[model samples]
Target: MLADSSSSLAHGHKGRTGLVRILFATRHSLAGLRAAYTGENAFRQEIWAASVMLPLALWLGQGWVEKALLMGAVLLVLIVELLNSAIEATVDRVSMELHELSKRAKDLASAAVFLSLVLCGGVWLAALWHRFVPG
Candidate 1:
Protein backbone atom coordinates (compact mmCIF):
# COMPACT_ATOMS: atom_id res chain seq x y z
CA MET A 1 0.00 0.00 0.00
CA LEU A 2 3.02 2.31 0.22
CA ALA A 3 3.81 4.91 -2.43
CA ASP A 4 6.83 4.37 -4.66
CA SER A 5 9.02 6.69 -2.67
CA SER A 6 7.90 5.20 0.63
CA SER A 7 8.50 1.68 -0.65
CA SER A 8 11.95 2.60 -1.85
CA LEU A 9 12.71 4.15 1.52
CA ALA A 10 11.86 0.90 3.28
CA HIS A 11 15.30 -0.47 2.36
CA GLY A 12 13.97 -3.97 1.69
CA HIS A 13 12.19 -4.23 5.04
CA LYS A 14 8.73 -3.81 3.60
CA GLY A 15 7.59 -7.20 4.82
CA ARG A 16 8.95 -6.68 8.32
CA THR A 17 6.05 -5.05 10.12
CA GLY A 18 5.24 -4.61 13.80
CA LEU A 19 6.95 -7.17 16.03
CA VAL A 20 9.12 -8.54 13.24
CA ARG A 21 10.54 -5.10 12.50
CA ILE A 22 11.12 -4.39 16.17
CA LEU A 23 12.91 -7.67 16.69
CA PHE A 24 15.12 -7.20 13.65
CA ALA A 25 15.95 -3.65 14.66
CA THR A 26 16.85 -4.76 18.18
CA ARG A 27 19.09 -7.48 16.85
CA HIS A 28 20.88 -5.10 14.50
CA SER A 29 21.33 -2.55 17.29
CA LEU A 30 22.81 -5.16 19.60
CA ALA A 31 25.17 -6.26 16.86
CA GLY A 32 26.26 -2.66 16.35
CA LEU A 33 26.95 -2.28 20.08
CA ARG A 34 28.96 -5.47 20.10
CA ALA A 35 30.97 -4.42 17.06
CA ALA A 36 31.63 -0.96 18.47
CA TYR A 37 32.69 -2.30 21.84
CA THR A 38 35.00 -4.88 20.36
CA GLY A 39 36.49 -2.95 17.47
CA GLU A 40 36.68 0.68 18.60
CA ASN A 41 39.20 1.46 21.31
CA ALA A 42 37.66 4.87 21.98
CA PHE A 43 34.25 3.31 22.35
CA ARG A 44 35.63 0.75 24.78
CA GLN A 45 37.21 3.51 26.82
CA GLU A 46 33.99 5.51 26.83
CA ILE A 47 32.07 2.42 27.93
CA TRP A 48 34.43 2.01 30.84
CA ALA A 49 34.08 5.65 31.74
CA ALA A 50 30.30 5.38 31.50
CA SER A 51 30.32 2.33 33.75
CA VAL A 52 31.92 4.45 36.46
CA MET A 53 30.05 7.70 35.78
CA LEU A 54 26.59 6.17 35.67
CA PRO A 55 26.79 4.91 39.25
CA LEU A 56 28.40 8.11 40.41
CA ALA A 57 25.62 10.12 38.79
CA LEU A 58 23.07 8.26 40.91
CA TRP A 59 24.87 9.15 44.13
CA LEU A 60 25.81 12.71 43.26
CA GLY A 61 22.51 13.82 41.79
CA GLN A 62 20.10 14.98 44.49
CA GLY A 63 16.97 14.73 42.34
CA TRP A 64 15.60 13.09 39.19
CA VAL A 65 16.43 15.98 36.86
CA GLU A 66 20.06 16.17 38.00
CA LYS A 67 20.41 12.41 37.74
CA ALA A 68 18.91 12.34 34.26
CA LEU A 69 21.06 15.20 33.04
CA LEU A 70 24.24 13.60 34.34
CA MET A 71 23.34 10.23 32.89
CA GLY A 72 22.17 11.64 29.57
CA ALA A 73 25.40 13.57 29.06
CA VAL A 74 27.50 10.48 29.53
CA LEU A 75 25.30 8.56 27.12
CA LEU A 76 25.50 11.38 24.61
CA VAL A 77 29.25 10.93 24.38
CA LEU A 78 28.88 7.25 23.59
CA ILE A 79 26.18 8.00 21.00
CA VAL A 80 28.35 10.58 19.28
CA GLU A 81 31.37 8.33 19.31
CA LEU A 82 29.41 5.53 17.75
CA LEU A 83 28.20 7.87 15.03
CA ASN A 84 31.73 9.05 14.41
CA SER A 85 32.99 5.53 14.16
CA ALA A 86 30.26 4.60 11.73
CA ILE A 87 31.03 7.56 9.50
CA GLU A 88 34.73 6.77 9.56
CA ALA A 89 34.06 3.16 8.77
CA THR A 90 31.82 4.05 5.88
CA VAL A 91 34.37 6.46 4.47
CA ASP A 92 37.13 3.93 4.78
CA ARG A 93 34.98 1.31 3.18
CA VAL A 94 34.38 3.54 0.19
CA SER A 95 38.13 3.89 -0.37
CA MET A 96 41.26 3.91 1.70
CA GLU A 97 42.81 6.55 -0.52
CA LEU A 98 43.66 9.95 0.96
CA HIS A 99 40.75 11.95 -0.38
CA GLU A 100 39.95 15.44 0.75
CA LEU A 101 36.25 14.71 1.14
CA SER A 102 36.99 11.65 3.24
CA LYS A 103 39.32 13.66 5.41
CA ARG A 104 36.71 16.36 5.84
CA ALA A 105 34.00 13.85 6.72
CA LYS A 106 36.18 12.16 9.30
CA ASP A 107 37.28 15.48 10.71
CA LEU A 108 33.71 16.69 11.01
CA ALA A 109 32.67 13.50 12.75
CA SER A 110 35.63 13.79 15.12
CA ALA A 111 34.60 17.36 15.92
CA ALA A 112 31.12 16.11 16.75
CA VAL A 113 32.60 13.61 19.15
CA PHE A 114 34.78 16.30 20.68
CA LEU A 115 31.80 18.58 21.16
CA SER A 116 29.85 15.78 22.83
CA LEU A 117 32.72 15.17 25.23
CA VAL A 118 32.83 18.87 26.07
CA LEU A 119 29.11 18.85 26.76
CA CYS A 120 29.47 15.83 29.01
CA GLY A 121 32.32 17.40 30.92
CA GLY A 122 30.45 20.67 31.34
CA VAL A 123 27.34 18.90 32.66
CA TRP A 124 29.33 16.80 35.12
CA LEU A 125 31.30 19.81 36.35
CA ALA A 126 28.13 21.84 36.82
CA ALA A 127 26.60 18.98 38.80
CA LEU A 128 29.67 18.68 40.99
CA TRP A 129 29.78 22.41 41.59
CA HIS A 130 26.11 22.52 42.47
CA ARG A 131 26.54 19.64 44.89
CA PHE A 132 29.80 20.63 46.57
CA VAL A 133 30.43 24.36 46.09
CA PRO A 134 28.69 27.03 48.13
CA GLY A 135 27.14 29.80 46.05
Candidate 2:
Protein backbone atom coordinates (compact mmCIF):
# COMPACT_ATOMS: atom_id res chain seq x y z
CA MET A 1 0.00 0.00 0.00
CA LEU A 2 1.34 3.41 -0.95
CA ALA A 3 1.67 5.88 1.89
CA ASP A 4 -0.66 8.87 1.39
CA SER A 5 1.70 11.73 2.34
CA SER A 6 -0.66 14.29 0.87
CA SER A 7 -3.36 13.33 3.38
CA SER A 8 -1.00 12.92 6.31
CA LEU A 9 -1.19 15.20 9.35
CA ALA A 10 2.34 16.34 8.55
CA HIS A 11 0.96 17.89 5.38
CA GLY A 12 -1.23 20.15 7.51
CA HIS A 13 1.82 21.37 9.40
CA LYS A 14 3.62 21.90 6.12
CA GLY A 15 0.76 24.05 4.92
CA ARG A 16 1.11 26.26 7.99
CA THR A 17 4.83 26.58 7.35
CA GLY A 18 4.13 27.56 3.77
CA LEU A 19 1.75 30.24 4.93
CA VAL A 20 4.39 31.67 7.25
CA ARG A 21 6.93 31.67 4.44
CA ILE A 22 4.54 33.51 2.14
CA LEU A 23 3.87 36.16 4.76
CA PHE A 24 7.54 37.00 5.16
CA ALA A 25 8.06 36.91 1.45
CA THR A 26 5.21 39.36 1.02
CA ARG A 27 6.72 41.73 3.56
CA HIS A 28 10.00 41.76 1.69
CA SER A 29 8.20 42.20 -1.61
CA LEU A 30 6.42 45.26 -0.29
CA ALA A 31 9.74 46.59 1.00
CA GLY A 32 10.98 46.55 -2.58
CA LEU A 33 8.55 49.36 -3.40
CA ARG A 34 10.72 51.78 -1.41
CA ALA A 35 13.86 50.54 -3.10
CA ALA A 36 12.26 50.72 -6.52
CA TYR A 37 11.94 54.48 -6.22
CA THR A 38 15.23 55.09 -4.44
CA GLY A 39 18.38 56.75 -5.81
CA GLU A 40 20.59 59.60 -4.70
CA ASN A 41 19.21 62.43 -6.80
CA ALA A 42 15.95 60.66 -7.52
CA PHE A 43 15.06 60.32 -3.87
CA ARG A 44 16.03 63.91 -3.20
CA GLN A 45 13.89 65.22 -6.04
CA GLU A 46 10.90 63.06 -5.13
CA ILE A 47 11.04 64.13 -1.50
CA TRP A 48 11.26 67.78 -2.49
CA ALA A 49 8.30 67.48 -4.84
CA ALA A 50 6.23 65.67 -2.24
CA SER A 51 7.10 68.17 0.46
CA VAL A 52 5.93 71.05 -1.68
CA MET A 53 2.85 69.33 -3.08
CA LEU A 54 1.48 67.53 -0.05
CA PRO A 55 0.55 70.74 1.73
CA LEU A 56 -0.95 72.24 -1.39
CA ALA A 57 -2.96 69.11 -1.92
CA LEU A 58 -4.33 69.30 1.58
CA TRP A 59 -5.14 72.97 1.28
CA LEU A 60 -6.79 72.56 -2.08
CA GLY A 61 -9.14 69.94 -0.71
CA GLN A 62 -8.06 67.84 -3.67
CA GLY A 63 -10.63 65.44 -4.98
CA TRP A 64 -9.83 61.85 -5.80
CA VAL A 65 -9.24 62.58 -9.49
CA GLU A 66 -6.70 65.30 -8.81
CA LYS A 67 -5.00 63.24 -6.17
CA ALA A 68 -4.77 60.30 -8.51
CA LEU A 69 -3.36 62.45 -11.30
CA LEU A 70 -0.74 63.97 -9.04
CA MET A 71 0.32 60.68 -7.53
CA GLY A 72 0.30 58.96 -10.88
CA ALA A 73 2.53 61.62 -12.38
CA VAL A 74 5.10 61.44 -9.61
CA LEU A 75 5.14 57.66 -9.53
CA LEU A 76 5.44 57.45 -13.30
CA VAL A 77 8.55 59.61 -13.31
CA LEU A 78 10.16 57.87 -10.39
CA ILE A 79 9.48 54.44 -11.84
CA VAL A 80 10.83 55.47 -15.25
CA GLU A 81 13.98 56.87 -13.71
CA LEU A 82 14.48 53.67 -11.78
CA LEU A 83 14.14 51.61 -14.92
CA ASN A 84 16.57 53.88 -16.76
CA SER A 85 19.11 53.49 -14.01
CA ALA A 86 18.69 49.74 -14.07
CA ILE A 87 19.24 49.65 -17.82
CA GLU A 88 22.40 51.71 -17.54
CA ALA A 89 23.68 49.54 -14.74
CA THR A 90 23.09 46.42 -16.75
CA VAL A 91 24.75 47.88 -19.82
CA ASP A 92 27.76 48.93 -17.83
CA ARG A 93 27.91 45.54 -16.18
CA VAL A 94 28.01 43.87 -19.57
CA SER A 95 30.78 46.08 -20.96
CA MET A 96 32.70 49.19 -20.06
CA GLU A 97 33.92 49.87 -23.58
CA LEU A 98 33.10 53.16 -25.27
CA HIS A 99 30.75 51.85 -27.89
CA GLU A 100 28.66 54.40 -29.72
CA LEU A 101 25.54 52.24 -29.81
CA SER A 102 25.65 51.50 -26.11
CA LYS A 103 26.21 55.11 -25.28
CA ARG A 104 23.34 56.13 -27.54
CA ALA A 105 21.03 53.60 -25.90
CA LYS A 106 21.92 54.85 -22.46
CA ASP A 107 21.46 58.46 -23.49
CA LEU A 108 18.08 57.67 -24.97
CA ALA A 109 16.97 55.97 -21.80
CA SER A 110 18.11 58.97 -19.80
CA ALA A 111 16.17 61.25 -22.09
CA ALA A 112 13.08 59.16 -21.59
CA VAL A 113 13.46 59.52 -17.85
CA PHE A 114 13.83 63.27 -18.19
CA LEU A 115 10.68 63.39 -20.29
CA SER A 116 8.74 61.54 -17.62
CA LEU A 117 9.99 63.96 -14.99
CA VAL A 118 8.92 66.86 -17.16
CA LEU A 119 5.47 65.37 -17.55
CA CYS A 120 5.20 65.01 -13.80
CA GLY A 121 6.16 68.63 -13.32
CA GLY A 122 3.52 69.71 -15.81
CA VAL A 123 0.88 67.71 -13.97
CA TRP A 124 1.96 69.23 -10.65
CA LEU A 125 1.77 72.74 -12.00
CA ALA A 126 -1.65 72.17 -13.49
CA ALA A 127 -2.97 70.72 -10.27
CA LEU A 128 -1.61 73.58 -8.21
CA TRP A 129 -2.98 76.15 -10.57
CA HIS A 130 -6.39 74.59 -10.59
CA ARG A 131 -6.40 74.40 -6.82
CA PHE A 132 -5.14 77.87 -5.95
CA VAL A 133 -6.02 79.93 -9.02
CA PRO A 134 -9.28 78.55 -10.21
CA GLY A 135 -11.02 80.50 -12.97
Candidate 3:
Protein backbone atom coordinates (compact mmCIF):
# COMPACT_ATOMS: atom_id res chain seq x y z
CA MET A 1 0.00 0.00 0.00
CA LEU A 2 2.83 2.37 0.78
CA ALA A 3 4.52 1.54 -2.50
CA ASP A 4 1.28 2.08 -4.37
CA SER A 5 0.75 5.41 -2.69
CA SER A 6 4.33 6.50 -3.40
CA SER A 7 3.97 5.57 -7.06
CA SER A 8 0.76 7.53 -7.28
CA LEU A 9 2.45 10.52 -5.69
CA ALA A 10 5.12 10.30 -8.34
CA HIS A 11 2.35 10.33 -10.92
CA GLY A 12 3.33 6.84 -12.09
CA HIS A 13 6.76 5.29 -12.82
CA LYS A 14 8.11 6.35 -9.44
CA GLY A 15 9.80 9.31 -11.16
CA ARG A 16 13.26 9.55 -12.71
CA THR A 17 16.55 10.04 -10.88
CA GLY A 18 20.13 11.39 -11.15
CA LEU A 19 21.58 11.93 -14.64
CA VAL A 20 18.70 10.15 -16.31
CA ARG A 21 16.25 12.62 -14.81
CA ILE A 22 18.36 15.57 -15.92
CA LEU A 23 18.53 14.27 -19.49
CA PHE A 24 14.81 13.51 -19.53
CA ALA A 25 14.02 16.96 -18.15
CA THR A 26 16.17 18.68 -20.78
CA ARG A 27 14.54 16.70 -23.56
CA HIS A 28 11.06 17.43 -22.25
CA SER A 29 11.82 21.13 -21.97
CA LEU A 30 13.06 21.25 -25.56
CA ALA A 31 10.02 19.32 -26.72
CA GLY A 32 7.72 21.75 -24.96
CA LEU A 33 9.47 24.70 -26.66
CA ARG A 34 9.27 23.01 -30.03
CA ALA A 35 5.61 22.15 -29.58
CA ALA A 36 4.77 25.70 -28.50
CA TYR A 37 6.71 27.19 -31.39
CA THR A 38 5.02 24.92 -33.90
CA GLY A 39 1.50 24.72 -32.51
CA GLU A 40 1.02 28.18 -31.02
CA ASN A 41 1.08 31.04 -33.49
CA ALA A 42 1.27 33.64 -30.74
CA PHE A 43 4.27 31.89 -29.24
CA ARG A 44 5.98 31.78 -32.58
CA GLN A 45 5.31 35.47 -33.08
CA GLU A 46 6.72 36.27 -29.65
CA ILE A 47 9.81 34.21 -30.43
CA TRP A 48 10.38 36.32 -33.51
CA ALA A 49 9.91 39.48 -31.51
CA ALA A 50 12.30 38.23 -28.86
CA SER A 51 14.92 37.41 -31.44
CA VAL A 52 14.89 41.07 -32.47
CA MET A 53 14.32 42.71 -29.10
CA LEU A 54 16.92 40.70 -27.20
CA PRO A 55 19.82 41.89 -29.35
CA LEU A 56 18.41 45.38 -29.52
CA ALA A 57 18.13 45.41 -25.76
CA LEU A 58 21.83 44.72 -25.47
CA TRP A 59 22.76 47.30 -28.05
CA LEU A 60 20.45 49.94 -26.70
CA GLY A 61 20.96 49.44 -22.99
CA GLN A 62 23.63 51.61 -21.32
CA GLY A 63 24.59 49.23 -18.49
CA TRP A 64 24.43 45.64 -17.38
CA VAL A 65 21.42 46.25 -15.11
CA GLU A 66 19.53 48.01 -17.87
CA LYS A 67 20.29 45.24 -20.34
CA ALA A 68 19.20 42.62 -17.85
CA LEU A 69 15.94 44.42 -17.21
CA LEU A 70 15.27 44.70 -20.93
CA MET A 71 16.04 41.07 -21.52
CA GLY A 72 14.04 39.98 -18.49
CA ALA A 73 10.97 41.83 -19.70
CA VAL A 74 11.09 40.09 -23.07
CA LEU A 75 11.69 36.75 -21.38
CA LEU A 76 8.71 37.33 -19.10
CA VAL A 77 6.48 37.52 -22.17
CA LEU A 78 7.81 34.22 -23.46
CA ILE A 79 7.37 32.59 -20.09
CA VAL A 80 3.78 33.75 -19.83
CA GLU A 81 3.04 32.58 -23.37
CA LEU A 82 4.37 29.12 -22.58
CA LEU A 83 2.26 28.94 -19.45
CA ASN A 84 -0.80 30.11 -21.39
CA SER A 85 -0.18 27.48 -24.02
CA ALA A 86 0.14 24.81 -21.37
CA ILE A 87 -3.12 25.87 -19.78
CA GLU A 88 -4.85 25.82 -23.14
CA ALA A 89 -3.44 22.41 -23.99
CA THR A 90 -4.52 20.99 -20.66
CA VAL A 91 -8.01 22.39 -21.01
CA ASP A 92 -8.33 20.94 -24.49
CA ARG A 93 -6.93 17.62 -23.40
CA VAL A 94 -9.50 17.31 -20.62
CA SER A 95 -12.37 17.66 -23.08
CA MET A 96 -13.10 19.21 -26.47
CA GLU A 97 -16.80 19.49 -25.76
CA LEU A 98 -17.62 23.09 -24.95
CA HIS A 99 -17.49 23.80 -21.23
CA GLU A 100 -17.61 26.98 -19.13
CA LEU A 101 -14.75 26.17 -16.77
CA SER A 102 -12.47 25.31 -19.67
CA LYS A 103 -13.31 28.60 -21.30
CA ARG A 104 -12.65 30.46 -18.09
CA ALA A 105 -9.27 28.83 -17.62
CA LYS A 106 -8.23 29.46 -21.21
CA ASP A 107 -9.46 33.03 -21.08
CA LEU A 108 -7.59 33.72 -17.90
CA ALA A 109 -4.42 32.29 -19.35
CA SER A 110 -4.84 34.47 -22.44
CA ALA A 111 -5.34 37.52 -20.28
CA ALA A 112 -2.10 36.68 -18.49
CA VAL A 113 -0.31 36.57 -21.80
CA PHE A 114 -1.81 39.88 -22.82
CA LEU A 115 -0.72 41.49 -19.58
CA SER A 116 2.78 40.12 -20.06
CA LEU A 117 2.88 41.68 -23.49
CA VAL A 118 1.77 44.98 -22.03
CA LEU A 119 4.50 44.78 -19.43
CA CYS A 120 7.12 43.96 -22.02
CA GLY A 121 6.00 46.88 -24.13
CA GLY A 122 6.08 49.23 -21.20
CA VAL A 123 9.58 48.20 -20.21
CA TRP A 124 10.93 48.55 -23.71
CA LEU A 125 9.31 51.94 -24.14
CA ALA A 126 10.71 53.15 -20.85
CA ALA A 127 14.19 51.98 -21.76
CA LEU A 128 14.04 53.56 -25.17
CA TRP A 129 12.63 56.77 -23.84
CA HIS A 130 15.31 56.99 -21.20
CA ARG A 131 18.00 56.47 -23.79
CA PHE A 132 16.69 58.60 -26.66
CA VAL A 133 14.49 61.29 -25.16
CA PRO A 134 16.09 64.34 -23.59
CA GLY A 135 15.09 64.63 -19.94
TM-score of each prediction: 0.90, 0.65, 0.89
lDDT of predicted model 2: 0.73
lDDT of each model, Cα atoms only? 0.96, 0.73, 0.91
Q: Clashes in model 2: which pairs?
A: none
Candidate 1 segments whose C-alpha is farther than 4 A from its true place: 1-12
Q: Over the stretch 3-53, how does candidate 3's per-residue lDDT look in tens digits?
A: 676766578443778888888889989999999999999999999999999
List residue ranges in candidate 2 displaced over 4 A: 1-39, 51-61
**What local lDDT score does residue 49 receive in model 1, on the 0 to 100 scale?**
100
Q: Residue by residue across 6-34, what tens digits does model 1's lDDT show?
A: 67657766567788889999999999999
Using TM-score as the measure, which candidate wins?
1
Model 1: colliding residue pairs: none
lDDT digits (tens) for residues 10-115 of candidate 2 = 6563345576868867887566546654644765576677677656655553787887777777668767776777788789897999999889989998899889
lDDT of 1: 0.96
